[model samples]
Target chain A: EAGVAQSPRYKIIEKRQSVAFWCNPISGHATLYWYQQILGQGPKLLIQFQNNGVVDDSQLPKDRFSAERLKGVDSTLKIQPAKLEDSAVYLCASSLASSGRGLMSEQFFGPGTRLTVL
Target chain B: AQSVTQPDIHITVSEGASLELRCNYSYGATPYLFWYVQSPGQGLQLLLKYFSGDTLVQGIKGFEAEFKRSQSSFNLRKPSVHWSDAAEYFCAISSASKIIFGSGTRLSIRP
Candidate 1:
């Protein structure tokens, strides 16, 4: 099976600019997630989607960041007026949907797009 | 919020030597545990995971981990190391819905 796919691979923009990243999860996977990985740190969850419906997005920066998964398939994460701190690797991941810890499953990640804001 | 800790920020080992990376999690209940590895310019790859039963769990690439409930620890180990093993290692903790991850451990191999 093909793995999750992400685009651009890398990006560079100035502060206050805008950028967007895309992701396509593995076939048959119903859960999708967006995570930010800062240098020397673990990946932090930004949002999660279960069949186009948001399951968790408490960590997302609503003021500048927005994400959507239309038709429960592909997803896009957009950041407008990006800040210096926004320079990080944006990762997209997917998992099989179940329920609870016992029901949920492991996450498969994409290659990720490295974004640098000057 | 629950958290994960990896005390060693960086570790260096000789090529062909044995390797071990420590991970400790803090949670009120028994949470899911996982270890992931990331190479330069690449995304994370799942190394292994421990949900329940049998404290000792094995992972890919000749890696294995021991889950100690008494110690709240899940450490990854390898009998022998290789130059290709150099990468950033991460330990993550997950509940039914939410998850948390440790900062990470940088493994360096000396040839």
Candidate 2:
């Protein structure tokens, strides 16, 4: 089976510039997520989507970051007026939707897009 | 607010030695725990997860994690360490349809 796919494994942009990262989840997976991993830190959940609807995005910085999933398959995360602090790896993961009783399927991750804001 | 913690920032172990990484979580109910490994410039990989049933769950790559509800901890253990095991390990918990990760523990193998 193919794994989650992401584009531009690496990216570089100047501060205040806009950048976008894309993700294509595993086929048939119903849940998708976007995370940000800073150097020497664990990946932080940025947003989560169950199908075409958002499940949670409370941690996301609404002023600068936005994300969307279309057709419940592909997702895009965008950051505008990027700052140096935004330099980090953006990871995408997907899993089968909740089976019931609050059980979650294992999540498969992509190689991730490393965004370097200079 | 649910959270996961890896008390150790980094650990070094000789090749062929036993290895253990610590993880602790804070949640109200029976927590869903997971351990993931991330190599340099790579995304996270699931090592193992604990939801219910057996307290000790074995995972791929000869890794295992034991969930101790009383202590609120899910620690990863490997009987023998390999050079290839060097990487960042994260412990996570799923709550309210979201997963939260710890800061991560970096493992270095000594030849």
Winner by DockQ:
1
What are the runs in model 1 whose C-alpha is more than 4 Å off? none
CAPRI quality of model 1: medium
lDDT tens readout by residue for model 2, A1-118: 9999999899999999999999999999998989999988888889988899988788899999999997899999999989999999999999998554323788899999999999
Candidate 2 docking DockQ: 0.60
DockQ for every prediction shown? 0.65, 0.60
What lDDT tens digits, residue by residue, belong to model 1 across residues A1-118?
A: 9999999899999999999999999999999989999998999999989999998899999999999999899999999999999999999999888467622577889999999999
- The lDDT of each candidate is 0.92, 0.92
TM-score of model 2's chain A, to 2 decimals? 0.95
Q: Cα lDDT for residue A32, model 1? A: 92
lDDT of 1 by residue, B35-94 (tens): 999999888899988888988999999999999989999999999999999999999998
